[model samples]
Target: MGAHDAGTAGRGRGKRIVVLDYGSGNLRSAERALAHAGADVTVTADLTAAAGADGLVVPGVGAYAACMAGIEASGAGPVIAERVATGRPVLGICVGMQVLFAHGDEHGVVTKGLGLLPGGVTRLPAERLPHMGWNTVTPPAGSVLFAGLPADSRFYFVHSYGVLDRAALAEAGVRVTTAHHGTDFVAAVERGPLSAAQFHPEKSAETGALLLRNWLATVD
Candidate 1:
C-alpha cells in the first residue's frame, strides 16, 4: 500500500520522528518544528533510532556534495535506502530532497545521490542565483502533504539547484508538486512511504505545520 493508504486511523498523536543530524540540516529548527507539529521528535545520528522511528526526516542545506559526504560519513546513506526499500516513511527536505535523486550537477562538479528518485538536480533557469523567500506550489490531486493547505498558501525556499523534469517521477507513479522560480521546478513529491519537499517547511509557518502534521498522520 502507498504511505497514505496506511490511513490516519489509530493515529494517536506524538508519532516518534527522527530528524537526522547529518551535519548539513537545520537540526534544532527541524526538531522544534516537528515537535510543534505533535511529533515526538529526536535529532540524532543514531541509525538504530532513525530506522526504528515511526518517521525519519532527512533535512539538509548547503551544497549537494557536502550533504552527501555527511550522509556517507554518518553511515546514513544505507539506512535511508533500507528504510525506503522496506516501505518505512522517509522525508527529505531542501538539499535533503535533492540528494534522493540519482545525481547533482553543481558548478560542473557531478556527485552521486541516494537514487531513490529517478532524476538529476541542476541549476534553475532563473536569473536570480538562489530562489529565496515565499512561493506558491501546485500539488497534485489527492496530495497528502498539501491536504488541508490552501491553494494559494506559500512556502519558504532557498536554493539554486532543483529537479526540473517531473516526467520520470510521474511515470513511476510518484505524486509531483511544482513551483516556479523563473522556471517550473519540483517543489515536493510523494510515493508510498517516501516523501520530500524542496522547500523548508520548518520555516514555512502554519502552512508547513499542517503539512508536517499531515505527514505524521501517515506514519504507522
Candidate 2:
C-alpha cells in the first residue's frame, strides 16, 4: 500500500494497467492518458497491482537517484524486473526509462538503475541542457510503439540526460529509436516485453495519444 491509486478497482472495466506510484513522475497525467487510450489505469504503489497488472507503466521525472530511491523504497524495482523477465509488458518514461539502464551518471555521481537494459544513462551531448519541447524521432523499422504513426511524428521531451550508447544497445540486440539532439541518442526501445520512451507521451498531444494507444493494443 502506497500513497495513491487512480482509476477504478472494478473488474472488466478495460485493459488493466498500473502507473507505478513510487513518489515520482506525472501520475495523474499518465492515468488520464492511459485511460483515454482505453486502459483501466491505476496509479498506485501497491506491489500486488503493479506485479499483476496486464501492463505496467513506470513514470518518472526529476533526478535519476531520487527516482531510483523512490522505486527502491516502494519495492517496485524487483517487481518491474520480474515482470520484464517473465515476458510481461513494462513501459518506462523519461527518467523512468533512464533508470531501466545499468546505471546513470548525474552531477558527478553514478547511481545504479534497475539494469533491465544494456546501456547506461549520461548527459546528452547537446549544446543546450534539458532538451525540452516537441521533436521528431527516428523509430526503428516496424516499431510497435511508433506503429500507425507517421515517420515525422513529434513527441514531447524534457530532460538533460539520455542513453547515447547506440552501439552498446545494438550489440545487446535491442530495437532502438533514435532522436537527434546534438548527437543521435535512444528515443524509444522495444525488445520483448520491455519498452521505454525518453519522451513524455502523456504530454505529447495527438501523436503521444496514438503511441499510448499502440501500447495498449499490445496488452493482453
TM-score of each prediction: 0.94, 0.93
- The worst-scoring run of ten residues by lDDT in candidate 2 lies at 1-10
Model 1, span 9-121: residue lDDT tens: 22516688999998999898998888877678889999999999989999999999999999999999999999999999999999999999999999999999999999999
lDDT tens readout by residue for model 2, 1-220: 1111222112124889999999999999999988876688888899999999999999999999999999999999899999999999999999989999999999889999999898799998889988999999998877888876787899999999999888888888789999999999899998989999999999998789778878877777
Clashing pairs in 1: none
Clashing pairs in 2: none
Q: What is the C-alpha RMSD of each candidate to the true structure, in Å?
A: 4.3, 6.0
**In candidate 1, how many Å is residue 26 off?**
0.8
How far off is model 2, as Cα RMSD? 6.0
Each prediction's total of clashing residue pairs, residues at least 3 apart in sequence or on different chains, is: 0, 0
